[model samples]
Target chain A: MSTDSAAGLLHDLAEYRARARRDRHGYWLPLLVFGVLILAAPLVYLPPSEWPPPRVQVSADGLFPGQIKVFGLTIEPLYMFGPGNGREIGNPMGVSWYWFGVVVLGLAGTVGWYRWRARRVGVETPTRLVVLAGSVGLLFLLGVVPLILGQALVLLFPGSYFYSNTAFWISVEVFVLAAAGTTVALWVRGGGPRPAWRVALASVGVVVALMSITIVFEAAFGHGHAPLLLLSVALLAVAAIERSAFCAVIAALFTAAALLANLYNMENVFYRFGFHVDYLNPRGEVFANLLLPAAVLIVGGGIAAWSARKASRRE
Target chain B: MSDHPTAGLDDVVHQKHRLAILTIAAEAKRVEFGYLQQNLDLTKGNLSRHITVLAEAGLLDVEKGYDGKRPKTWVRVTSAGRRALAEEIATLRALVARHENLS
Candidate 1:
């Protein structure tokens, strides 16, 4: 075949593939949901007003020491439930609990939305892959990443780690590292030569990033802000799943906002404008984190909706 | 085992319409019959015949199911089909490079 003909064929195939991928995307629904969820997060972080979102009470009545002795089992295998570590971090309502619910709902909502949209639009994205990406990312960021970073903190400043059990944590770190190393080795074995170097580069980069994030945030925001970074990672996973450059940009911006909120006292920005953040009400990092990421998602959803429609018309 | 890339051209997957079908189907987990038929601008019978040919060659898995009361035909590319498609693309890329070099 002639070069022009060959090139033309490739182009045609690529166009079909792009069209297929694009037709399947309903990312705007999830982006909007994510934005609203982020906006609602500060409420969970702050003291409630006259009316509050009803808190689901889990009674510790079932009696436990890392096990539901009544049932002789626990549903949560990764995190065995333990009783009474009732150390409060600012709010009465748990922000971590809020995030946990939101992340689960968000992933679940993604699957439901795609299935619903498929019934309407005739084509649907592979929701299984998207949900899988979100779940894996959720586990990595919420569970694994903090432990790894905690180990780094222990190494960098001895006796400075947040959790006190040094020996247990060391063993946990060793096991986690071995698991991660084996997984990396498996990926790199058949993935050509440079991947080993890339893995090393990535390891160094992650360590440097963890240290920098900790150092930067520790002075301004102080403790419990690490988990706040989890929100942006979910956006990133969806972006990767959809292969949407637009969603990826929004995710990056959200990550920056989350980092900024974590490090800098956002009330200072408000204070410069002669608007003091009322101590009684939600303010400061709460507002800063909420507005930027929500704006990114809510605005991004609008753009995605428009783009999807435009692409549909073009097709 | 000819050295020429043309020798690698897959007879089953080489035609333009079938290649387009594979390309589209390969993008998603599974593709609906109506969507493919509409996208490729093919008659129901024509597309069915093509699907049958690919299914017979073990390149496509055809499932007839109910989406409600309505019957839907779904097509998925098998592992062999993915390998075939990848080989076809590589061969095409090689063919283009060879042509470009001669020019």
Candidate 2:
């Protein structure tokens, strides 16, 4: 080959290498941040003795006392009790650290995977970042803020909190049902224009029926039964007919619900091994409680947006 | 002898770097000027000139603003631009199909 051709080939090879380096850099930075966070979780759980113990106050008549003797294991409360004798408990050390690790790692892994795929296909970072930001923003607006506000209100009002109100409970159930239904419907539609009213209504019906079956199954088996298992199955069925986002959104909704149930002590199980783990310190709890869902939302949203953009380009 | 018109359809749509800008805009719906510059690996002046050409042709709309102290420029495709792109793609497809048939 001529010198000109050889020079062109070398330049092209250099360009390819540079692109690869940039992509790798993008992939590793998020992973490193996530890994560091996970590694640091244990420190939060087993803080130095000099680090002031999280202040926890329990009301004399708090529904669940600071101490619970369950099957002979003495479990201390997980949140901090305030001046009003309201029970304050922090996360259990093992559970909290485990969840913090899971969430941070999960988020970083998801974001990294997404960016890697986009880079492989030559999608730009700004577009990916916008989608990521949008997803996180939506999650904060829908899930994290509500959770924080709910917890704060519960702490402030103690006995008089709306968390225990029938209306509020009904609303929560309705919202969950709606979210699950919409997710299924969107999945069925498969990134097309929104479905017609009848289709949407039918999806809602299906969701309600599934929810009813779950409740009945729970009643038959035991109250502490895992709702996520059923939801996951439903999501799988939806995935078979529709898009993966439907499944992802459904899974996220179920995860959020499980988190909420744990937050309120509605679930008899304190924390499961995989996603429900929490970091035990008050500051850690605050961080995990606020950050985990936010991360999931952002990461999930970014993937969805990026996918949508990719599909559009192909068309 | 070729009887068909619009033989330059590919030339129109696949012009160097212009297609890149259009592809980016079409996927993103709206994109920042700095982002376009970084992703397309173009100098600010080169990108600005290309953007000006597209804007002149009514293929794109450009907006400029400031974020705190930093100036920002955003670009989006116009309806006419989308139609033109669609026509260009169709013409190219037709040409390919004709060539395949002849072969």
Candidate 3:
């Protein structure tokens, strides 16, 4: 080859290398972290005896009766089951399977959607592995923190878990609100269509109104309010349809509200549907703590995967 | 052939450094000045000049605050900046497609 051609080849090689570095560095690292966490979920459930038991004490005078202590805070136990006579009754493995299934399904759906969209667009979209990683990290900070705190509260001060410690719920709500708001702001400012402030304000107003209405209906119908649960489920479904960070926020808010309402009334719609809230009890706190957050993470993860696949197909 | 389809593709933002800065800023909700400098591998002076150009173009908003007593500078892409960056990318892609097809 002539000297000019040789130099030209070298230049092209350099450009390729530069592109590789840029794309690889930004995209792959976070994805690897996410993958590791997903793979580690099953391993998290060791034998129950290896797990610490819920610390519960009945008062001598029956004055502070049936209180459970967790994380240095004292709260009444939500249920009065007989203390463990060494027969491990609860199914941590089943609970893990349910959560894992939700996450996997959600991720698959998201990945599938993205791949389809990318193919249709006929442009290579950026790798969303990094974005997925960031989302997972955000989930840990926002979703996981509140959940752990909520579980701790339930274990420690069972009586006050539902009502008196409004701060915990409020903190969770704030995190969810901020995450949703930041995402909307970023999306809008990132060149997506700008939604009107009035629309947002109206949506908030409507959510509050609906929640209040549900509460009233629940009061009238007692704990078995199918309509209220249906409403909650519908809202969650709508949030998923919206397919933005705001949707995740809305889903989280609705889930939190539903959980609180259930706890307050000592009723579990999730349980009626064969989902367990017994895990929320002191003995099963870790499973309770991990389950819902993991569900939300998986949902978000699925969306990220879908978005990535869409981007790749476009490319 | 032009090295880049985006090469000399003039808009309000065809400048290379400015494009890089905007891209970085757009990805982050907020990014520190030093982080931008390190990522772009630009000198402090070079980064500052490009940042100024972007700020003037209304594509970025630069804020200087104190993290304790030390001064901290952060950059964020404005809505206008995001639009410009998106337009730039689309234009670049189109140019590349056109050139590739012709070749």
Candidate 4:
């Protein structure tokens, strides 16, 4: 071909590369939404006049007592279960409510300000395989290992395990081991080209990110948050890989999972635990509590996927 | 046609801006004109001129719509345009190889 045609092709290729380098709306929006959703409940929750929504309570005698023993750890039962009356337990994260909102809001605002000020560009694709494996490993360590060890400890020292310092120490050690394992796994796969120091730094960053997420989620909702949290992370990652219509489908699946989680949590706390508080508008409260958030997640994911498709059509 | 890289290059797709437009359009189901213009860093007049030429050659399907109140234009590469672009690139690569051999 002529010089002009060759030059044109090169120009187009260069343009494509440049566009690829710039951050697309598709990935960033969903990521931002994910961050917001994760932080929103903890940071922006306002106490209703009638707290805990509408629920029916059943009196259980001595079901919970002061410093109830569980797997060798003496933990406070937020609920009072005595002779004639048993009150609903306040959530473990209740103390966090006093300070969590201000702290999270401040942190989120500061980060938002910094990001906006910096006006950074470009999309950085994490090592998906390494990150995925490390994430799964992290979950196993944080979750499965703890339960297994706790069970073993209970079996080994039936009487002594309760309210023991050993339990706390064991928990700490397991946490560290899990974090280290995940970081090392990530580094082994993705750190070869980087300097040793950089690898160490990246490993720390990965560990910190994973740990912070675990802590925030654990702190925010404590038990039963894991399944939905894992689902969200997995779906978002998949959306990044697939993009567009497929992402929309993933978003829908994520919504379904989230719905199940909400139902399960509500059922566990409300009916099983018999901790029910009246709502000003019970039906509206139920709809707002369960359906609204699920709808937003589903729609938000769809929009993000659509934008991603439009922005980067290539698979 | 001669057995030269330049022999069968399509004129509509040979221009710099138009080629970039085609490549971008080919990637998306239908690429917004604004995306093409912003990505290629071309002024409205310049992009319009190139887009008009490609449209005339039946290489681009241009659609006019409204994004809320604002008018929007979207462009997609026709099948013919996709074939032409592929042929053009292949020819251009061959031309480069032949020239390098000569050098």
Over A263-286, each residue of candidate 3 has an lDDT whose tens digit, in order, gives 443324455666665443433333
Off by over 4 Å in 3: A1-315, B1-8
Supply DockQ values for each candidate.
0.57, 0.16, 0.06, 0.12
Per-residue lDDT tens digits for candidate 3, residues B9-96, read 5555776567766666665445667766765679999999888888898889988877668687878789999898777666665664
Q: Please provide, for model 4 over A119-176, each residue's C-alpha lDDT reduced to its tens digit, 9 standing for 90 to 100.
A: 2221222325324643674445344433433343455446745335564455456557
Candidate 2 lDDT, tens digit per residue, A1-315?
A: 223433343344345334432332232233233334433443344433325445456656442444444444333332111111221233343433344334434544545564455434443233243235434533432233333333433443356433244535554476567667766765665566765884768676655544433333222222111222222233233233222444346445645753553243421243453345333333444334335433543454455456555754774
TM-score of chain A of 4: 0.32
Global lDDT of model 2: 0.46
What is the fraction of true interface contacts found in candidate 4?
Answer: 0.21
Model 1: CA > 4 A from native:
A1-4, A43-91, A94-97, A137-228, A283-285
Native contacts recovered by candidate 1, as a share? Answer: 0.62
TM-score of 3: 0.36
Sorted on TM-score, best first, the list reads 1, 2, 4, 3
TM-score of each candidate? 0.71, 0.39, 0.36, 0.37
Q: Candidate 1: deviation at residue A53, Å? A: 14
Q: Assess the local accuracy of residue A83 in candidate 3 as a C-alpha lDDT between 0 and 100.
A: 21
